[model samples]
Target: MEVICLEDAAFYTLIETVVERIKEKLSTTEDKWIGGEEAMRKLRITSKTTLQKLRDEGKIRFSQPEKKIILYDVDSINEYLEEHAKERF
Candidate 1:
């Protein structure tokens, strides 16, 4: 195999470019998902059952990326809250 090397300045520039590209990609979000704990915390609830009920009733959407893991869409949770917001005088 042939060996390739970059000088100090060139290496730093390459690293900076890679980091910027990664940041840009990360900043562009399609959908954000949160775990049960975070969702409950956001909604100020202490029961996972409540979240499960929402999922069961199809009030919100969830994803099971793994066999035993679940994630809820942040936008759906926020939308649910907005839809159910109470009227204040």
Candidate 2:
């Protein structure tokens, strides 16, 4: 086995490159969780209250893993849109 050594600057560049690659991979992965703000944007709503009401009424599914942050399942949001879509015939 051979040992490879890097100088200070080289080591930092390697670390930075690794970090960037990891970020790219994560960002490109299938995002299954949609944050509250993103969901509102997708639904063209301007208020979190509207989303909260839907959550409270069980009209939409959501998860609050933390005290202040909520995430909705992308599939559920898509289903809600389909259910509420207007037909143009």
Give each model's whole-structure lDDT: 0.89, 0.87
Each candidate's number of clashing pairs is 0, 0
Candidate 1, 4-56: lDDT as tens digits: 89999999999999999999998997459988888887777888888899999
RMSD of 2: 9.2
Best by lDDT: 1
For candidate 1, the per-residue lDDT at 19 reads: 100
Candidate 2, residues 1-89, lDDT tens digits: the string is 99999999999999999999999988895478889888898788998899888888887788899998899887888898999999999
